[model samples]
Target: MALFSGNQKNTAQNVYTNMRTYLAQKDGAVHVVLINSFSQLANQVFKCDEKYTTEIDYVLNCMQREGYEILDIKFNSIPNQGMTGNRTGFNTLITYR
Candidate 1:
C-alpha cells in the first residue's frame, strides 16, 4: 500500500523511480493501492503533513508516462472516526508490461 502523505511530490517521484527499477527486472503486472486522507483532522491525528496531499491525476500521469496502463480505479469513502471526519480514500489497480 502506498500511503500518500508528507511531501507528496517527492514521494510520488520516489515511488515512480522505484517502480521503474523494479519493473525492469520483473515481468508481471503491478498493482498499486494508494490511500490518501484529505481530512485535516485526520491528518493532524496521523501526523501527516497537510501542506500537500497526493493528487490522483499527477500519479496517474506519471505512471502512464512510463507506459503503465491503468487497469482500474476505485474509490471508497472512509467512514469518519470519532474526532476525524470527511476523509476520502482511493484504490487503484495499475498494470505494467
Candidate 2:
C-alpha cells in the first residue's frame, strides 16, 4: 500500500534516511505512485526559500527513483469554486490510467 508521510519538516539527513527506507522496502514489487503537482510547489508563497525548493525536489526525485510516474498538469484559469486557483490547482488530475 502507498503511504504518505504527514507533512513535516525533516533535516537533510533524515530525508535521505527515510528515502532509503522506502526504496529498500518497495523494490519494484508494488506499483509505487507519488501524486503531486506543480501547483503544490507553487503554493508555498510564505515559506519561499531555497530549503523549500530543495525539499520539494527531493520528494519528487525520490518518487521518480522509486519508478513512480510524474504527471504535470497546467490550467489556464480557476474554476467556479471560490478559491485561489492562481497556483494552477484547477488544472491537475492524477489517474492510474
Candidate 3:
C-alpha cells in the first residue's frame, strides 16, 4: 500500500519514480491511496502551496506500461473535526502477474 497526501514538494515525476521502485520489489496486488486535491482549509492547515499535483491518469498509464492491470478505482473522503473539513482522495487497485 502507498499513501500520498499530495504534499506540495512531491511532483508527478517523484510519484512515478517512487511507484516504480515499489513495483520492482513486489509482484502482486498494489493499493494506492492518493490525495487528489486539497480543500482550502486543508491547504492552510497543511501549509501546502498546491504547487504540484499528481495526475491520476498519468500515474495509472505508467503503471500499465510496467505490466500491471488496473483492477479498480474508487473515490473516497474523510470528514475532519473542525476547520479542515472533508478530505477527498482516490484509491487505485492494481495487480501484476
Q: On residues 20-68, what C-alpha lDDT tens digit does candidate 3 reach at each position?
A: 7556434574555443433333443655323323455566677778676
Candidates' RMSD to native? 7.6, 9.9, 8.2
Clashes of each: 0, 0, 0
For candidate 2, write residues 1-97 as lDDT tens digits: 1122234235433665654553434333433323232333344366543433454556556556756664552224343332554353232232111
lDDT head-to-head 1 vs 2, winner: 1
How many clashing residue pairs are found in candidate 2? 0
Candidate models: Cα lDDT each: 0.52, 0.41, 0.50
Q: Write the per-residue lDDT of candidate 1 for residues 1-97, one digit (tens) a residue.
A: 2354545667666766655654442346555544343433444365543423354555668767866667777665455543445554434444444
**Order of the predicted models by lDDT, top scorer first:** 1, 3, 2
Q: On a 0 to 100 scale, what is the lDDT of residue 23 in model 3?
A: 62
Clash tally for model 1: 0
lDDT of 3: 0.50
